[model samples]
Target: MSNWVEGQVKEIKWWTDSLFSLILNADVEPFTAGQFTKLALQVDDKRIARAYSYVNAPSDPNLEFYLINVAEGLLSPQLAKLKAGDTLMIERHATGFFTVDELPASEQLLLLSTGTAIGPYLSMLVQGDVWQKYQHVHLVHGVRCNADLSYQDKIKQLQAVYPQLIYTPVVSRESANLGLNGRVTEVIKNNRLFDLMPHCVTPSNTQFMICGNPQMVKDTTALLLDRGFTRHRRREPGNITVEQYW
Candidate 1:
């Protein structure tokens, strides 16, 4: 059977000129924190589809997704104009390789993402799965500005409730009382991820999950590998797991 499920758009909120959010009424199918579902759309009596990651955790009744608006793109262009009571389609099955399950148990877990790519990481964080498996959960999200730093309250709450969880927001374009500033890879290169930790987070005990731009993943993966982190696989376990946002 096809994995897609039919869903309706209960609401829409713009995050930035090129970013938006969607809320749907669907009992989320059972999924790991870093999985994604394909969203189907209809245009002029023809049905089409686009995949989006869940930004909300399973504990939440309403399914939420953070989206990036491609101004010239087909689905996103139409999607951005939608309002509550609008119609859409969702797949029943969700899948991805960037969840905690891909990494072996470790002392420290780093969740790295940028832009809407932070969606899956947020999903995993709110699921309460990382806290159960690791002693330290560090979430590093890179954006262009403060407005791009979505889920501010959610991240703060999670970190506060779970003292072991560390939330770090990195912005590369704008600064000035806007929290940490720099690209995710640049921060890792500049020894920033380690700076936020109360103690050193080393490759010997740290497992990383990276998402967002492919370049970000590549650079961060290269850095981690140099520090002794490995790319995990079905059989062989490694320290770094990446999900390409596109």
Candidate 2:
């Protein structure tokens, strides 16, 4: 890892009391759509840093990060307090291979995520490569409440522009007219998710990209494996690519 590079905060978009997106102007090496970078800030005289996935596409001039303010977290609380013109530290290199190009060619692409894990998928969606390769794309975002479903309008706008794109939001806690009311795993388990896709989300025809809560990732991965999907690896490229949000 490289020493931290300083970047100036360009903007901050707070979607809820605890969730927000940060935009920074930084110069760094190019990275793939789903790659992540380290962010740091001085707190209590200590340089606190954490890895965050990029929300902006690789082509974007500004770097964007979707973050959650954990009441007890050391870094997030400080990150949430940042304003435009504030200095933020970032790694010189972007890292991770959680991208669509890692998977084999498929007819359909499914992006499953929860909470801020939707960040990386949003980066991938804005890139032309994903749409160019797959005939259909499905993005499912799951949150505890409808209010936590950030970037909903942006996703819907993408859906409106792309006939092959399907955007489904799932709320697990409260009844939401904006989205399906259920856990994401339950929605997938009951075939409610597939109903929204233009093509059947099958192991043979679709490639799965899952990111978010570790437990949800574990359960969903197990479910997919049981139904015949294979996990991607260097030696054997498969139907599913996963990134667990810790």
Candidate 3:
């Protein structure tokens, strides 16, 4: 039996020159929200594959993945060139421990992501379990520029339906009217990030899920550690849970 199954591209949504969402139709096994699966393409008889977090909820009929075209990337540049009806190989099963189910009980859930790393949080948010599980949900997306912030409409819709969901968009490069204007770590360090939120962010009341570029994840986790938060583990059960989006 083959582990890879064929997936037909249904649509390509370009949010910016470098960022896009690839929507496909494939018969993949049920995946939990916030998990990721691999997508592959055959190049010169050698298969190249990369892992992408699912942007769509498990109930959604189609599979959606948000990605940025790395200028010199082996697979992403080719992925960006794909058009409707093109076929690619998708891993039959998804895997990751980023799901909300893995977190311990807490009053607040802080989901922090940078760039396309926001995809998994979008999945968890749309799936509707986060709202019921946490009293307050803070979704912070940090992007280099205003244009990098995608899915505003979807985030707004989710906010409308779930008042408990609070979104904060941090733009590091330029000014943005929507949310705070600084890097996520900088804002948090200066207490500006906490000022925007309605609830307090103590380790006892909040559980942090940090995902994004390796640097952002490392810095954020370090800051949280400085504030007395510890890395979450199955046996130890601490405060911070992280997934590095390479």
Candidate 4:
């Protein structure tokens, strides 16, 4: 067998206009819900590696990941061309710090994501840990329009049963009766991020997870810090956990 075996592409699903999910039959031990894995593509005699966050539950035998097709990415160009039978290299090890396992227990889990950065959050939710820990799980996703609101059916179904899980879609421009009509930072500045929790994200019993654009990550991190939320790190532990993928 090849040391780096080819993972079989099993399933493909589109969440939104720009997001797509692919399932691969990766041969490896189970990874944590919020870890990332690298994908390799053959170029001449060398292999190119690109890291991607997991978007599936670890209990599942096969590996799955969500991706946003960026027109300029060299690897994404070939990754998008894959089909059910097609093959792509899957890394044996999965790693990342952006998981619910790192942060301390809290009453509220504020998952603020943008674009394709919502991958890990979705994985966390699908794994059932989101509702397991927090009394209230609030997901504030920022996108361009309703068409960008991926996982609508799945998110809504979760909200229907678990009223504790709330989803607020923030659209910057296109808003045809979708959700909030502005950028997520503007919403946070207006105290919208705390509307889900009665007491807000205080150091007492709230935690934050932010992903997406660099500006958004920076602005939201500063805003949370001003509100008494500290960054969660391996050394200096705080209430906020962030993974900047911009």
Candidate 5:
């Protein structure tokens, strides 16, 4: 009864110099839409692993993981070199509490993410459950530059299918002609972010799911708290939910 299973690399999609997505074929157990699983590789007779959220829907035949090749990292560098047909180790069961089912009832659902942290939200979006649960769903992805905005076609496809799905891309380094040209927290603080949304954000109507780098998550949580939002818990249901990537 081993916990690890073999996953064959089906494809590798390179979006940028540091960003990539691994499409793998593995017989993983049924996972919730927003859950994450660990991938491992043997390095110097030792096993190196890292947790990565699934980008594909749970029902999809292929298991997909979005990742960034961290410079001077241990596991990611090896993972980045993997090719189609190569085998890797994947945990048999996915785990995480970041699914939509964990949220409290709200009219609006805001999914804010940065970099590769957008993987889980993409999972939830494509799974088709969020659209039915919330009247309006906002997906805000904050990136350093326009080139870091990966999965545009997939997001556009979901937008077409679900008209209520609002996507706001925040490019901080340079001007984003189509999107906001500031950090997500800055835009929200200055009231520029909500300008693109269909309705105003209130603690009563909005449930925030913020996932990204630790700094972005921390700052975003603090900003929301300042606006009267509280951290969500099963015993004490509140507005903001968060998951930090690295």
Candidate 6:
């Protein structure tokens, strides 16, 4: 059984053929910037629930989420059809440890994500508190095409406020004439990411937070471990934190 509260669908933003964002108006429990909450809708006799990371800052007036529309997904396709007056089920409490606060203080924080996985990082960015802990913060977002780079405008706004924030949007398939062109794992391995940064991205001075496709998460984690980065844990603090989005 789940304790779910109803939230009004305040708005919807469709970014591309497969991507969209939902804004829900509800009074939610105060949550950490990078936590996620479950959204549900009744389908026939069953309640289909899915977890989505918040794109809005914890203090933002409305709850926002970025999502990918899976044609066959039980919930996402239905979610795509929602309108302003529709109601959605939001979990009473948010949950997840994929936040900057969970990592040890470091000189630089590298946030790596792909597709809608960038949602939580966006929340952390807009909250504007990560700037106080680390001198430098870098967000590397990977997508298949230029059209999929959804939040450049928002990132630009944040960069204006925090000059230390660095954003690198990577297009893996098409050459966008924008940022880098390669898988984020390859970019990090080949030293291309550091080339654009002010400081070196080493295990000693950098903490890595990775969120994205399962394959990307696995591949990236393997690469980082080989380079001496350890996975973060409750008892043993290390240089890497990861969340795999399905």
Off by over 4 Å in 5: none
| lDDT leader | 3
lDDT of each: 0.80, 0.89, 0.93, 0.80, 0.92, 0.91
Error of 2 at 194 (Å): 1.4
Question: RMSD of candidate 1 to the true fold?
Answer: 1.8
Ranking by lDDT: 3, 5, 6, 2, 4, 1
198-244 per-residue lDDT for model 2 (tens digits): 76667779899999999999999998898898998979978879997
lDDT by residue for model 5 over 198-225, one digit each (tens)? 7888888899999999999999999999
- What are the per-model C-alpha RMSD values against the true structure? 1.8, 1.4, 0.8, 2.1, 0.8, 1.3
For candidate 3, write residues 1-246 as lDDT tens digits. 888999999999999999999999998999999999999999889999999999999999789999999999989999999999999999999999999999998898889999999999999999988876798898999998888889999999999999888899999889986788889899889988877667788888889999998999999999999999999999999999999998
Q: What is the lDDT of residue 183 in candidate 4?
A: 90
| Tens-digit lDDT string for candidate 6 (122-196) | 999899878877999999999999999998789999999999898998899988568899999889889888788
Looking at candidate 4, the ten consecutive residues that score lowest on lDDT are: 192-201
Minimum summed lDDT over a 10-residue window in model 1 is located at 1-10
Clashes of each: 6, 0, 0, 0, 0, 0
Q: What is the lDDT of residue 3 in candidate 5?
A: 88
Q: Which whole-number lDDT from 0 to 100 does residue 132 have in model 4?
A: 68
TM-scores, all models, native as reference: 0.93, 0.96, 0.98, 0.91, 0.98, 0.97
